[model samples]
Target: MARTNPLQFVQQVRSEVGKVSWPTRREVMLTTVMVFIMASLTAVFFALVDMAIRGGLRGVLSLFG
Candidate 1:
Protein backbone atom coordinates (compact mmCIF):
# COMPACT_ATOMS: atom_id res chain seq x y z
CA MET A 1 0.00 0.00 0.00
CA ALA A 2 2.85 2.39 0.81
CA ARG A 3 5.29 3.39 -1.94
CA THR A 4 9.02 3.05 -1.25
CA ASN A 5 11.47 5.67 -2.54
CA PRO A 6 13.96 4.57 -5.26
CA LEU A 7 16.99 4.62 -2.95
CA GLN A 8 15.20 2.78 -0.18
CA PHE A 9 13.92 0.21 -2.67
CA VAL A 10 17.43 -0.41 -3.98
CA GLN A 11 18.79 -0.81 -0.45
CA GLN A 12 16.01 -3.17 0.49
CA VAL A 13 16.62 -5.26 -2.60
CA ARG A 14 20.34 -5.47 -1.88
CA SER A 15 19.73 -6.49 1.73
CA GLU A 16 17.33 -9.27 0.72
CA VAL A 17 19.73 -10.48 -1.96
CA GLY A 18 22.59 -10.60 0.53
CA LYS A 19 20.55 -12.79 2.86
CA VAL A 20 20.22 -15.49 0.19
CA SER A 21 22.62 -18.47 0.38
CA TRP A 22 23.71 -18.88 -3.19
CA PRO A 23 24.93 -22.25 -4.45
CA THR A 24 28.58 -22.83 -5.24
CA ARG A 25 29.66 -23.37 -8.85
CA ARG A 26 30.33 -27.06 -8.22
CA GLU A 27 26.94 -27.56 -6.61
CA VAL A 28 25.23 -25.82 -9.51
CA MET A 29 27.09 -27.92 -12.04
CA LEU A 30 26.32 -31.16 -10.22
CA THR A 31 22.62 -30.35 -9.93
CA THR A 32 22.50 -29.29 -13.58
CA VAL A 33 24.00 -32.60 -14.64
CA MET A 34 21.61 -34.53 -12.41
CA VAL A 35 18.66 -32.64 -13.89
CA PHE A 36 19.75 -33.50 -17.42
CA ILE A 37 20.19 -37.16 -16.53
CA MET A 38 16.79 -37.34 -14.88
CA ALA A 39 15.16 -35.59 -17.83
CA SER A 40 16.73 -38.01 -20.29
CA LEU A 41 15.57 -40.97 -18.26
CA THR A 42 12.06 -39.56 -18.10
CA ALA A 43 11.98 -39.01 -21.86
CA VAL A 44 13.14 -42.55 -22.49
CA PHE A 45 10.48 -43.91 -20.15
CA PHE A 46 7.69 -42.00 -21.93
CA ALA A 47 8.97 -43.02 -25.33
CA LEU A 48 8.85 -46.69 -24.34
CA VAL A 49 5.35 -46.30 -22.94
CA ASP A 50 4.19 -44.59 -26.14
CA MET A 51 5.66 -47.35 -28.29
CA ALA A 52 3.96 -50.02 -26.21
CA ILE A 53 0.61 -48.27 -26.51
CA ARG A 54 1.00 -47.83 -30.27
CA GLY A 55 1.93 -51.47 -30.75
CA GLY A 56 -1.04 -52.63 -28.70
CA LEU A 57 -3.42 -50.44 -30.73
CA ARG A 58 -2.03 -51.72 -33.99
CA GLY A 59 -2.35 -55.35 -32.88
CA VAL A 60 -5.97 -54.84 -31.79
CA LEU A 61 -6.90 -53.08 -35.03
CA SER A 62 -5.26 -55.81 -37.09
CA LEU A 63 -7.30 -58.49 -35.33
CA PHE A 64 -10.58 -56.72 -36.17
CA GLY A 65 -9.62 -55.71 -39.71
Candidate 2:
Protein backbone atom coordinates (compact mmCIF):
# COMPACT_ATOMS: atom_id res chain seq x y z
CA MET A 1 0.00 0.00 0.00
CA ALA A 2 1.11 3.57 -0.72
CA ARG A 3 1.62 6.01 2.17
CA THR A 4 0.40 9.60 2.02
CA ASN A 5 2.11 12.51 3.77
CA PRO A 6 0.11 14.25 6.55
CA LEU A 7 -0.32 17.47 4.51
CA GLN A 8 -1.46 15.56 1.43
CA PHE A 9 -3.88 13.50 3.53
CA VAL A 10 -5.38 16.64 5.06
CA GLN A 11 -5.79 18.24 1.62
CA GLN A 12 -7.42 15.12 0.24
CA VAL A 13 -9.79 14.94 3.18
CA ARG A 14 -10.79 18.59 2.73
CA SER A 15 -11.39 18.06 -0.98
CA GLU A 16 -13.57 15.04 -0.34
CA VAL A 17 -15.51 16.88 2.38
CA GLY A 18 -16.16 19.78 0.00
CA LYS A 19 -17.75 17.42 -2.52
CA VAL A 20 -20.33 16.12 0.00
CA SER A 21 -23.95 17.30 -0.27
CA TRP A 22 -24.78 18.18 3.33
CA PRO A 23 -28.38 18.11 4.52
CA THR A 24 -30.06 21.30 5.77
CA ARG A 25 -31.14 21.68 9.40
CA ARG A 26 -34.78 21.26 8.49
CA GLU A 27 -34.11 18.14 6.49
CA VAL A 28 -32.04 16.70 9.30
CA MET A 29 -34.76 17.43 11.83
CA LEU A 30 -37.44 15.87 9.66
CA THR A 31 -35.39 12.76 9.06
CA THR A 32 -34.64 12.46 12.79
CA VAL A 33 -38.33 12.76 13.63
CA MET A 34 -39.25 10.20 11.01
CA VAL A 35 -36.65 7.80 12.40
CA PHE A 36 -38.00 8.16 15.92
CA ILE A 37 -41.57 7.68 14.74
CA MET A 38 -40.68 4.58 12.76
CA ALA A 39 -38.68 3.18 15.67
CA SER A 40 -41.59 3.69 18.05
CA LEU A 41 -43.99 2.04 15.63
CA THR A 42 -41.65 -0.89 15.22
CA ALA A 43 -41.31 -1.27 18.99
CA VAL A 44 -45.06 -1.25 19.43
CA PHE A 45 -45.49 -3.84 16.69
CA PHE A 46 -42.98 -6.17 18.29
CA ALA A 47 -44.49 -5.68 21.73
CA LEU A 48 -47.93 -6.68 20.43
CA VAL A 49 -46.49 -9.73 18.69
CA ASP A 50 -44.69 -10.76 21.87
CA MET A 51 -47.84 -10.36 23.93
CA ALA A 52 -49.80 -12.50 21.50
CA ILE A 53 -47.17 -15.23 21.58
CA ARG A 54 -47.02 -15.18 25.39
CA GLY A 55 -50.76 -15.32 25.72
CA GLY A 56 -50.94 -18.24 23.31
CA LEU A 57 -48.27 -20.10 25.30
CA ARG A 58 -50.06 -19.51 28.58
CA GLY A 59 -53.36 -20.68 27.13
CA VAL A 60 -51.78 -23.89 25.83
CA LEU A 61 -49.98 -24.54 29.13
CA SER A 62 -53.14 -23.91 31.13
CA LEU A 63 -54.97 -26.57 29.16
CA PHE A 64 -52.28 -29.18 30.07
CA GLY A 65 -51.77 -27.96 33.65
Candidate 3:
Protein backbone atom coordinates (compact mmCIF):
# COMPACT_ATOMS: atom_id res chain seq x y z
CA MET A 1 0.00 0.00 0.00
CA ALA A 2 1.20 3.58 -0.81
CA ARG A 3 1.55 6.03 2.09
CA THR A 4 -0.37 9.30 1.80
CA ASN A 5 1.76 12.49 1.54
CA PRO A 6 0.51 15.91 2.79
CA LEU A 7 1.47 17.71 -0.44
CA GLN A 8 -0.28 15.09 -2.55
CA PHE A 9 -3.47 15.62 -0.49
CA VAL A 10 -3.50 19.36 -1.34
CA GLN A 11 -3.10 18.62 -5.07
CA GLN A 12 -5.87 16.06 -4.89
CA VAL A 13 -8.20 18.60 -3.25
CA ARG A 14 -7.44 21.24 -5.92
CA SER A 15 -8.13 18.78 -8.73
CA GLU A 16 -11.49 17.79 -7.21
CA VAL A 17 -12.50 21.43 -6.73
CA GLY A 18 -11.69 22.23 -10.37
CA LYS A 19 -14.20 19.59 -11.55
CA VAL A 20 -17.16 21.07 -9.62
CA SER A 21 -19.89 22.84 -11.67
CA TRP A 22 -20.81 26.00 -9.80
CA PRO A 23 -24.03 27.97 -10.19
CA THR A 24 -24.05 31.15 -12.32
CA ARG A 25 -24.57 34.60 -10.77
CA ARG A 26 -28.00 34.97 -12.42
CA GLU A 27 -29.17 31.63 -11.13
CA VAL A 28 -28.04 32.55 -7.63
CA MET A 29 -29.87 35.88 -7.77
CA LEU A 30 -33.07 34.23 -9.02
CA THR A 31 -32.96 31.58 -6.31
CA THR A 32 -32.38 34.20 -3.62
CA VAL A 33 -35.32 36.29 -4.83
CA MET A 34 -37.61 33.25 -4.91
CA VAL A 35 -36.64 32.33 -1.39
CA PHE A 36 -37.39 35.85 -0.15
CA ILE A 37 -40.79 35.93 -1.85
CA MET A 38 -41.80 32.57 -0.40
CA ALA A 39 -40.65 33.61 3.06
CA SER A 40 -42.61 36.87 2.95
CA LEU A 41 -45.77 35.10 1.79
CA THR A 42 -45.50 32.55 4.58
CA ALA A 43 -44.95 35.29 7.17
CA VAL A 44 -48.07 37.18 6.03
CA PHE A 45 -50.20 34.04 6.10
CA PHE A 46 -49.03 33.09 9.57
CA ALA A 47 -49.55 36.65 10.86
CA LEU A 48 -53.18 36.66 9.71
CA VAL A 49 -53.80 33.26 11.27
CA ASP A 50 -52.25 34.36 14.53
CA MET A 51 -54.34 37.53 14.62
CA ALA A 52 -57.54 35.54 14.02
CA ILE A 53 -56.69 33.14 16.86
CA ARG A 54 -55.89 35.98 19.23
CA GLY A 55 -59.07 37.79 18.40
CA GLY A 56 -61.16 34.67 18.94
CA LEU A 57 -59.52 33.99 22.29
CA ARG A 58 -60.02 37.59 23.37
CA GLY A 59 -63.71 37.39 22.54
CA VAL A 60 -64.16 34.14 24.42
CA LEU A 61 -62.42 35.50 27.52
CA SER A 62 -64.51 38.66 27.43
CA LEU A 63 -67.72 36.59 27.57
CA PHE A 64 -66.58 34.96 30.86
CA GLY A 65 -65.41 38.22 32.45
Best by TM-score: 1
Q: List the residue pairs that clash in candidate 2.
A: none
Model 3: residues >4 Å from true position, as ranges? 1-3
List clashing residue pairs in candidate 3.
none
User: Each model's TM-score, in the order given?
Assistant: 0.92, 0.89, 0.86
The better candidate by lDDT, 2 or 3, is 2
Residues 1-65, candidate 2, lDDT per residue (tens digit)?
A: 99999999999999999999999999999999999999999999999999999999999999999
Residues 23-48 of candidate 3: C-alpha lDDT, one tens digit per residue: 99999999999999999999999999
Q: What stretches of model 2 exceed 4 Å from their correct place?
A: none
Local lDDT at 26 for model 3 = 100
List, residue by residue over 33-59, the lDDT tens digit for candidate 1.
Answer: 999999999999999999999999999
lDDT of 1 at 12: 100
lDDT assessment of candidate 1: 1.00
Q: Model-by-model lDDT, in order?
A: 1.00, 1.00, 0.98
Q: What is the TM-score of candidate 2?
A: 0.89
